[model samples]
Target: MAGAQMVNSHPNVKKYLGFALLPQGGVSIGLLTIVAVQMTQLYPIIAAVIMLSVLVYETMGPVFAKYSLTKSDELYGLDKLNESMFEEDTEN
Candidate 1:
């Protein structure tokens, strides 16, 4: 359960929200590229939507998970120097 929890994330990190949305966008674009090149009349609207989703994803996904534990530990007082919890709050 602890592993599932998100802790010690930085302001520079995407906070998972941005990163999660990005994958959907990437998949949409990829599908759209394949379909658009085919130029079939199956569903142009669907392809367009996919491409649009990709644009949104790339703009947001890479923003998160930017900071690592090493960087946080080095600069910030992460995990109390020897604490395993990666604690940020003094009373958490």
Candidate 2:
């Protein structure tokens, strides 16, 4: 939700796209790694995928932090600034 506008307008779309995809990809890869670990033949491939997923998770930390900072106060009620739920639209 945070990057919806940036998805279309960001100069380096690929970088933003990668930022968006990393978490999803990491989870999928992590699942695959679990399944691969159960099978004996895919050990090497799964190990590499697990490592890649770790890197992906690391890359996603900042993107996650940015969204968390924006929404944390609203979601957790840590502060009460502008608590109106039905403000009139001021923008055209």
Candidate 3:
């Protein structure tokens, strides 16, 4: 029942696909770069760039999520949209 409810609520599987891609996308690229650098004992510059990219994303991600989660605009938008639909259109 709970699984069915969740699927009903989140009708779009694209969200799940998006969540699956996040860590495996840019982060994977960075990890591979770092691993390659260590394997070849090459310039630290490439490794540094990869590490910096990862750190920047890690630092900003939570802040972005928190800000997004706390935003009242979502509730307002939902309420505003629902109100008109539920209310009779008197102008007609």
Candidate 4:
């Protein structure tokens, strides 16, 4: 997820993703250890599948966040036409 954080445009996205990844550090150690223990029994293709799935999942986060922010920006601007309706009159 370090790769995703590096390219994410939003600060919240990077910060949250960083926090989410912290626990994975320990989890990964255990997972890799298990995988290593069974290395001789595993097929080579399984390793490739694991790497590809992780890359795809990591890549989708930033892309989804980018589009989500873009959609939010659009929604935020939707009420601009009514902004003047609430303005106080300053005419003498």
Candidate 5:
């Protein structure tokens, strides 16, 4: 969020601020792996927590990204595409 705030000064840039808030599980998981290897005592609990966090973030990240794009009006034709996917084919 701090990254977002830093770029929030510009009107156009503000719309893309959500991109900065997107979760990056790869980096977190990599660092967690290193920490777990270095400190074996806290490995189990810390690993569990980090895995859970990554799972939650991975699931919700797309939703947040889509919401941000929607709010910024940057989805283009994606909404239409999504809607079309759910529509039944009358000719079938």
Candidate 6:
């Protein structure tokens, strides 16, 4: 949030900042693997939570991104595509 604020305040290019909330499954899985190898006891609990988090995030990330883009009016091509598809379906 602070970083987004700083970017927005500064003369940098604007960004959707919400993208930062997206999950990093590869890195998390790698670290979790290390934990599993080194600290076997804590691995189960940590792995379960992290895996669940990753699953949820992965599932919802695209939805959130689409919502953000739609809210920002940046999905012009997608909107057009959907309209064209709808028109084609109706015509058929």
Best-matching candidate per TM-score: 5
Selected candidate, larger lDDT, 2 vs 6: 6
lDDT of 1 at 32: 68
Candidate 1's clash total is 2
Whole-structure CA lDDT of model 5: 0.73
Instruction: Give me the runs in candidate 3 sitting further than 4 Å from their true place.
Output: 1-26, 29-43, 70-92
Query: Local error of candidate 4 at 67, Å?
Result: 6.2
What TM-score should be assigned to candidate 6? Answer: 0.58
What is the C-alpha local distance difference test score of candidate 2?
0.55
* Candidate number that wins on lDDT, 2 or 3: 2
Task: Give the alpha-carbon lDDT of every model.
Answer: 0.52, 0.55, 0.52, 0.52, 0.73, 0.73
Residue 23 displacement in candidate 1 (angstroms): 4.4
Screening candidate 2 with a backbone cut-off below 3 angstroms (N, C-alpha, C), the clashing residue pairs are: none
* Clash counts for the predictions, in order: 2, 0, 0, 0, 0, 0
- Model 3, range 1-92, lDDT digits (tens) per residue? 34535666433332233322233336656576667857766546666776676676566755544444344233255677877876756545
Each candidate structure's TM-score, on Cα atoms with residue i matched to residue i, is: 0.36, 0.37, 0.34, 0.33, 0.60, 0.58
* Model 5 lDDT tens row, 31-74: 99798779899988899999998898888888877776666665
Ranking by TM-score: 5, 6, 2, 1, 3, 4
* Model 2 lDDT per residue over 1-92, tens place: 34745566444332344344445555666677577758868877776777777676767766864554444332334334343432434431
Cα lDDT tens digits, model 6, 8-73, are 642221355465357567787888989999999899999999899889888887777777566655
- Model 4 lDDT per residue over 1-92, tens place: 57756786456554444433332333444465677668846835555665665565566655655554454453344466456544534332
Clashing pairs in 3: none
